[model samples]
Target: MSFISVNPESDFSIHNLPYGIFSTQANPKPRPGVAIGDYILDLSQVSKLFVGPLMRNEAEEVFNQTTLNKLMSLSYEAWHEARQTIQRLLSKHEGVLRDNSELRSTAFVLQRDATMHLPAQIGDYTDFFSSLEHAINGVKLFVDGDKALFPNWKYSPLGYHGRASSIVVSGSPIRRPNGQMRPIDDRPPVFGPCKLMDFEIEMAFFIGNTPNKNGDIVPIDEAHKHIFGMVLMNDWSARDIQKWEWIPLGPFLSKNLGTTISPWVVTMEALEPFKVVNVVQEPKPFPYLYHADNYNFNVNIAAAIKPDNGEASVVARTNLSHLYWTMKQMLAHHTITGCNLNAGDLMATGTISGPTPDSYGSMLELSWNGTKPLTLSDGSERKFLHDGDEVIFTAHSERDGCRVGFGECRGKLIPALAL
Candidate 1:
């Protein structure tokens, strides 16, 4: 496909074809749009003014909805159909959308003036510690490298239920949370603002196609059938709070603050060409849990931190392939307990740090349990995220000679006010 005008740097390039909800800042009503040439082609507006024969014939109801959820709930074939339709409409060919001047006036909106909104109405969220390297590193920091991995990790995907209500759109600032922490020297837990705020470098899988019948819980092998797409995710954390509260039941106050997701949802169909085996196992998965392609995609992920006022500092570079458990494994494990998943639900890959000091995903690990500090390029030191720290996560796949990038997932930190 010929590259369209939305500069290559723009997240919505032809290779990207990411979907999101948008509207002009003046009107901010939250409607569907496709990024094209420094502009957002408003699907809602295009649905009304578009006189194109093919699009008019096949434009599904998803385009009419305010968010991408309607489109996402459709089947993979349906998604492909919509993508093809949108691509053609966006093409620079003479007989394409440009054929109608009035249509262009109504459909095209500048991206800068556009207000980006949540891509979907997330119903529920589940976080999984799917990265072996990350889990080992975390263990090594608290325990040691020899027993870096714990029980129930090598066997299946270890995960925890997360808060959906707290998830936020990109650019929204996160607040430093009030949490309970313990002092080292024979002191009881004290209440104060979290001192070790951090961001988890990860990716999120979006669920779609809810099972309708009595046997509604989807099997592991068929999990992909119900998924919509993937997004770059930053699962923010408060290490100080987690340490105090996490004696028995996992994360609570530390995780509930705010999680951020990239504005665009990269469709599952776009990634179909590059599916590989999830894990190399001698003991294959059980029959019911196994389908066909049980492999993971080679999606490259990275994290960066920038002061609210200054340039970004590169943090970690990792990939989904490094994950011990794949999305399929996580889904299989989720439904192994017969849990029913709904449309718009999210399954996240937990903290994705690699095995090294420089590859640490969070400051807690890089600082070695707060023993050291990270020296930034600007000569600043960071033991933990401060009041004005901003973190960004980006995920992309370079396959078939195409670099498909999912726009940055970002959040700013604001200090907690005394209550």
Candidate 2:
């Protein structure tokens, strides 16, 4: 619908104006931008055109920033206004931008010439075990059916605090972590490079601009207002290290090595059309965690692995709807104890796996704890990732011929440092 041509299959269509921070060699300063077809609408160049009352005065300042934190810290109304203004400016009938040849040249940059950066300066991060199939798979691999489903899991969304310092934008290189692990049951633990490096395919959301008071709880109905948007994520893991250290505590160094996320943050407004019925929750949740509306999305998620010299092969496919705990429920439970949340905080749905082997989200589950090896397109077999292996995650939702997507969340594994 825009003056510019957009391919029907392109992830960034007229329907999806995802936001991110980007830079180019000509203008090395990172600034906010929106993805559109094969080009990026440099928000900094078009900031003055945001004439809406809510964004008219503030657009220039926020769009010129190096990170999205300031913009994300705005109210829900402001976010909506900004999106509406952008959509209008890009409309085919909007002569302001479509007819301005000089403005168009400076405002649009080819995507290939721009470098993407983290959308926001994340202050905190949490990863939740929200997928029923993934949880069951873990139980089957490590423990017996007697402890098939942990009793506390059904009551609330269980999660662990994660390190935010190591979180990286997509395309970063992840060096294998070195840690202690008990390789043999009868032998003492040894410290060295990880033997079971894996990737957890996940989808994460950024908290909106408002911050909750330390003693206040976020009601389930209001959780959506506190969420800004979603992105694809790869929570790289060193399974051997995690198994040895996650006894009394959960995920330490094994999880902190590196986490990668897609650059573009697909807004909730763009995904509204893809909303589907929430998964049935037996033993109805407490009032604080219950919501009548559907928060589950039908986003299709998939992960693939590519060797340095080989073609990529998809190893797993799943849907965000597989999550047992909805994002709203997770947020409501997160603040039930009065824990404060700030703008740009991140929360992720952990390992979204479906009920079949092909739908598993992690290498750990896909290979059944390394007992089964997966053969790649080049006939190379992998029980776990090798030094040159690259993990790529993609997610999208489509309905009525419109598609909204999170571009590739990718990372390559490199050799660990020598002790």
Candidate 3:
């Protein structure tokens, strides 16, 4: 892996490289780009870079248009092939994109002139609660102590369907939602605005393809074959509204307001250099969910809040290694009953908090179920997000003197509609 000319400290710099869709204001047509220095090398314009067994005459077709939808539709092997090609083209080798002044203008553009779009045309989105620390803290609020953890937690991945339509690309505005929320002392539930809006710092996996059989679940050993990459996700919540309506079903209005995903989809191959072990589990998983080798990989994950008008405060920083279950286990368990997972489908690790207070991934945990108050820099106490507040989630891989990061997941809160 040759070193490319990139900023020493930029989040999108070489050590922190990733892929996404973007284009200038002059050309709104979305195209694939790999982050280098402060600019996005426009792959759509430099189509010749894609060649070889991936495609012969049509090798350049992947970059002909904007949005990774066409490329994302390819098989997992194609995804890896394309990633490797792009990585090489962006590498320190001077012949490709580096020293060629003639191709520089056509190949590179300042990132500021462009807007980042959703990297994939998501087919489906599923969220899994796989963090042991986050689960324990949350469960303790309701159950408390070792009893806080459910007996079956170590056996399977807990998951639920999420709204794909509401999953926004980074930098979009998120409006507060009108829903039912009841004060702890209220007589009954009140039909009004949400007071406890929240941000869930999480990491989600991108599925590249499905199993051979339709409706068949991905097996544990082969789950990585279907995985494309990873991104930071914020499953925004309306905690007060959730409290009132979460009776029989898990989440409805509270969890659906607006979810944000990082623009870059850092490929799994890019993360291979930093794979770490998964969190330790007291009771080993059942046969179907167990893997002989690695159960999960390590990626340093984190979340921070930059008030709409203030400086950034690192509210939480944790690791993907804290996950109780491996992505393979989750995918295998998800499909053991015969559910299908398609290419571009998303699976998330819910609220990836560590064992300490600084790593509390969500306001619900930080505020301790609304009983305690979170003090901010400006002397403001937050039980939940106030209008105009912003939340951001970021992830990266840094070790052995290298770094790779997901840009950011940012959204501002707007006043709830009067409806």
Alpha-carbon lDDT, every model: 0.76, 0.93, 0.78
lDDT of 1 by residue, 192-276 (tens): 8888888888888888766334344567667777777888898899888887787688888889888999888887777766677
Each candidate's TM vs. the true structure? Answer: 0.91, 0.99, 0.93
How would the candidate models be sorted by lDDT, starting from the highest? 2, 3, 1
User: What 10-residue stretch in candidate 1 is worst by lDDT?
Assistant: 49-58
- Candidate 1: C-alpha lDDT: 0.76
Model 2 has an lDDT value of 0.93
Q: For residues 103-222, what per-residue lDDT tens digits would candidate 3 score against the true structure?
A: 887788888888999988887888899888888887776445557477777778998898998999988999999888777644877888888888998888887654545657677888
- Model 1 scores a TM of 0.91
* Predictions: Cα RMSD each: 2.8, 0.9, 2.2
Q: Which ten residues in a row have the lowest lDDT in candidate 3?
A: 1-10
Cα deviation of 127 in candidate 3 (Å)?
0.7
Model 3 quality (TM-score): 0.93
Error of 1 at 398 (Å): 2.7
Which portions of model 3 miss their true places by more than 4 Å?
A: 1-4, 142-147, 210-212
Expressed as tens digits, the lDDT of each residue in 27-142 for candidate 2 is 99999999999999999999998899989989999999999888888989999999999889999988999999999999999999999999999999999999999888888775
Best by lDDT: 2
**Best prediction by TM-score:** 2
Tell how far residue 294 is off in model 1, in angstroms.
5.0
